[model samples]
Target: MPDVTKAIASDIFSGRYPAGSSLPTENELGVEYGVSRTVIREALKVLAAKGLVLSRPRVGTVVCNEDDWNIIDPQVLAWHAPHALDDKLFDAILET
Candidate 1:
């Protein structure tokens, strides 16, 4: 459950699912992760607790804005750290 939560959070940090964008349906995520919908639901709940996402009735889960994120949370910080490398790498490539 923690792994799935981290994976989804990482996706948000990496901009794969930007703020205000709805995540894939639970069914779709279940298929992608090979887990049951219940597991996906729990993972979503965790993300919500972290202020990384919000659940909208009939609309699905949407990522929260950067301002809404619990950036000070240790887990959130750790999950977001790796994504910073992507920007640095891009800058390096552009300078070459």
Candidate 2:
């Protein structure tokens, strides 16, 4: 269960889903991952609690804006820190 949650979080952070995009339906995800809908639901809940996604009635789950994400959460921070530093290095190089 935790593994699924982390894997989904990693995918989200890697831009596989991108912010503001609706996630695949629970049924779709379950079929794709070979898990039950309940597992997919649990994973979605994990993301929602981290502020990376939001669940709405009828509309299902959608990724939150990057600004709304819990940027300081250890897992989230680990995922983005390297990319942020790389961006900074690129910016410095561009100024030369």
Candidate 3:
């Protein structure tokens, strides 16, 4: 579950899901991660509370703007920079 959240969070911060872009539906995420819709919603809620995403009815969840991200939070930034050791996503990490 944590891995799924981390992966989704990383993708959002890396601009894979750019600001204003809608995220996959909970059902889609559940299928992708092989988890229940309830788990997907919980993971999304974590991102939402961190201000990395915004969930709206009908519109679905969307990645928030970079300026709205809690970049100063170590945990948040770290979660988005797992590949930092190899510089694989260094540029993307800096972008956030």
Q: Which ranges of candidate 2 are over 4 A from the true structure?
A: 79-96
Which ranking of candidates, highest lDDT first? Answer: 1, 3, 2
Q: Per-residue alpha-carbon lDDT of model 2 for 13-75, expressed as tens digits?
A: 778889888989999988878899999999888789889999999998889987687765666
Model 3 misplaced stretches (Cα beyond 4 Å): 83-96
How far residue 33's Cα lies from its native spot in candidate 2, in Å, is 1.4
Collision pairs in model 2: none
| Preferred candidate (lDDT higher): 2 or 3 | 3
Query: Please, what is the TM-score per model?
Result: 0.85, 0.77, 0.80
lDDT per residue for candidate 1 within 1-96, as digits (tens), equals 888888899899989999999999999999888899999999999899889999989998999997787766678778888888465434544665
Report the lDDT of model 3 for residue 44.
91
Inter-residue clash pairs, candidate 1: none
Clashing pairs in 3: none
Residue range 33-71, candidate 3, lDDT tens digits? 999998898999888888899999989999998668676
Give the CA lDDT, 0 to 100, for residue 46 in model 2.
Answer: 76
| C-alpha positional error of residue 66 in candidate 1 after TM-score superposition, expressed in Å | 0.4
